[model samples]
Target: MSQLANDSRVQVRKKSKERSKFFWGMVYLAPALILMSVFIFYPVLKTIYYSFYYTNNRGIPVTFAGLDNFINLFTSESFLISMRGTFLYVLYTVPLGVVIALFLAVISSEKIRAIGIFRVIFSSTMGVSVAAGSMMFLFLFHPTIGFLNHIIGLVGISPIHWLTDPKWALISIAATSIWMGIGFNYIILLSGLQNIPEDMYEAAKIDGAGYFTRLFKITIPLVSPTLFFVIIVTVIHSFQSFGQIDILTQGGPAESTNLIVYSIYQNAFIHTKYGLASAQAIILFVIILIITIIQFKVGEKKVHYQ
Candidate 1:
């Protein structure tokens, strides 16, 4: 009876210690939880609430609008145009950026002398801020004083109004996005490429495989996981692009470059339609969620391991 009592006392002490640890752990995490609740959770919930109501300029709810906000969003031609432009930007930028980055990464992975210099040159754009890149591109693409026009003029080509012309404004912005995105994708793919087993390539070469065969059969499949991740993130970023458009075009050139994020910002802040902006934001959330889901589903089948 005495031994059993002693064992029970030890077990109780152990359980008490665990409980104490758990309580303190919560205490340590309380600040982060509080911060998230105030900043992230509260804003998300408030945005959802605002989406269902008419709101004043100060964001105070005035009247219940039911599905009116969502309906209006779909019916609004500007919003539809913005959505189409955003999708176009994604379609234009993502694949080109991924392909360029992967190509650079593969080249950088070679055993060439002074390869580090080339790697740095390729990835230096990663450090360029969005505003800086936009400004640089803006100057370069300026029809009159721009270096691009000057260079092309030497080849007997006419000057193109990159930002002012509706035909080229969105495409020009996409080019800028792709240029900035390339560095990031290159870094990720380079890291992935570096991790690939050298033995795999050696074995393939031993089997009399050519360069293209080795690249297609081995390198691409091995680096596919990183490529998949880059594609998803690139799509998301392209969808949410705002800084470059704001700095360069302000969604002008006849609203040709007015992407969804710019539209949301315009509606929320400039137009003082918080409810409508929130509704647009929610729709964007849904679109991103669906795209991400599709990516994951498709990636599971495509992402090759080892």
Candidate 2:
């Protein structure tokens, strides 16, 4: 009877221990879970709800308008322009960022001396905030007092309006975005490059393969997984670009540089058209989701884990 009683006590103790562990685990995760629910999930659902209601003057009425907000978004010209500019921005930024990052990664992975210093210099831009970097680039390309204009003057060329000119404004913004993004992508790609085995390169060299040939055939394929990640992230960032447009151009010069996110901000906060803005935001979200899904679907087929 004593032995049986002891076995029951042991089972009770084991159950109590498990309960304690489970309780502590819940305690540890509670704060993060609550935050996610409050901020992320709640806001998303609230936005969708708000998208169906219209507000008039005096801020009192919020009548349900069903799909009117969505229909308005489809018919809006400003939204269309913003979407076009956003598409162009991403089209340029993603490919440029990936290529430049890969180039920097390859250079940094070389056997040359001072690689650490180069890495630090390249990655330092990542520490700078987007607004600050945009402002700095704005000054650098400023038409009259800008350093770049001075260099052009020395070469007997006229100073080009970097921010004010509609033709060059988006291009300038894209260049700055590429410069700012290169550092982070370089670090990621460099880490991936470091993980590659040196034996593969050695074997390629023994087979009389030159540097460029081996790089094309082996290095690129091996690093494709990292490249795919960089491409997706860069594309997303480009789609969400607003700060550069806000600070550098303010969507001026005929709204040539206004992106979708900036236009949404203008509608919600600036224009006080909450319902319409919410609909626009939902559309943007759906577009991003579709693009990201497509990227993963296509990338998985091309990515080589080995």
Residues 23-99 of candidate 1: C-alpha lDDT, one tens digit per residue: 99999999999999999999999999999999998878999999899999999899999999889889999888899
| Model 1: ten consecutive residues of lowest lDDT | 297-306
- Model 1 regions lying over 4 Å from their true place: 1-21
Give the best candidate by lDDT: 1
lDDT of 1: 0.94
lDDT of 1 at 287: 99
C-alpha lDDT values of all predictions: 0.94, 0.87
In terms of lDDT, the poorest run of 10 residues in model 2 is 53-62
lDDT (tens digit, per residue) of candidate 2 on 118-171: 999878888989989998998899898998899999999999998889888888
RMSD (Å) of each candidate, 1 decimal? 1.9, 3.1
TM-scores of all models?
Answer: 0.93, 0.90
